[model samples]
Target: MPSEGRTFIEEARRSQIIECAVDVLATEGYARASMARIAQRAGISTGVISYHFGGKQQLLEAVVSEVAKTATDLMMPRILAQTTATGMLRAYFESNLDFMRLHRKPLLALVEVVTYNRGEDDRAPGPYAEQHETSINDVIKLLDRGKSTGEFRDFDSRSMAIAIRGAVDAVPARLLHDPALDLDALAGEFVTLFTLATRRQP
Candidate 1:
């Protein structure tokens, strides 16, 4: 039982450090979000962060995972609640923008990390690349489902998926510039635009 207690405490500490890192990344950008800065934000020594995560890169990776999970948690329910492709598409755009509205900081941190974090081989960060590809594939599958169900017009699923994902992905940068931008308006516009693009004309 003692060991279990220690493990639980460690998990909580790790969560605290990750949350601090997210704030530092969101506010300072990736280039400036050094481990020491994150440590100071967490009110802990850098050694503690290093002990939990081997280095800055790992911590940033964890930040990406955490933010993505949070987004999924918020979005999947909305998406699943819909019964039609059009409804699902609407929910997808609405929920995504709503997430940005509710959790701007974590999304900004994720953008920073994905934009700047590179591996030792100078490759793009693995987590973002993998997650992005999976996102696209998920959209493609959704589009195909609509097609199979005769709910959507005939179009290239992959292309439409890419376009949809691109539209959603562009929001983070826009938010950085226009913090007060009407995301609800934007969300409605996206739903209208993509729904028209994909839905079969009766």
Candidate 2:
């Protein structure tokens, strides 16, 4: 029970640090979000961060992972609940936007980390990049499902998926610039735009 209690406290501290890191990353950009800054935000020492994550790169990876997991947990259910390809597509956009709207800080942090953070070898893509590739692949599968079912017109699934991903991703930067932008309306526009693009013409 003592070991279990220690593990719980450690997890709690890690979560707190991750949350602070998200805030720092969102506001300061990844390059400026040092361990000291995050530690200050968390009211803990930098050594604590190092003890938990070893370094900034690992902590940034954890930030991406935690945010992505939260988004997936929020979104996958809505996407999975849909019975039709069109419904799934609409849910995909709506749920993604919903998550972004509700969790702007985490999304912003994710954007900054994925956009600017790099690994030891500058040429190699990082974990966040790999996660994005996985998301694109998932969208391709969804598009293929729609095409197979005749719910969507004939088009290159990869191309359409990439377009959709780009549209969704461009939102965070937009929000960064215009915090008052109506994401609900924007989400509606996206659903309509992609629906028109993919749906079979009457």
C-alpha positional error of residue 171 in candidate 1 after TM-score superposition, expressed in Å: 0.9
Worst 10 residues of 2 by lDDT: 1-10
- The models' CA-based lDDT, in order, is 0.89, 0.91
The residue-by-residue lDDT of candidate 1 on 103-181, one tens digit each, is 9999999898777766555854555877888899989988998998999999999999999999999999999899999
What global local distance difference test value does model 2 have? 0.91
Q: Which candidate number has the best lDDT? A: 2
**TM-score for all models, in order of appearance:** 0.92, 0.90
lDDT of 1 at 3: 38
List runs of model 2 lying over 4 Å from the truth: 1-6
- Candidate 2 lDDT over 84-133, as tens digits, reads 99999999999999999889889989988878877767887786987898
Q: C-alpha displacement of 91 in model 2, angstroms?
A: 0.6
Residue-pair clashes per prediction, in order, are 0, 0
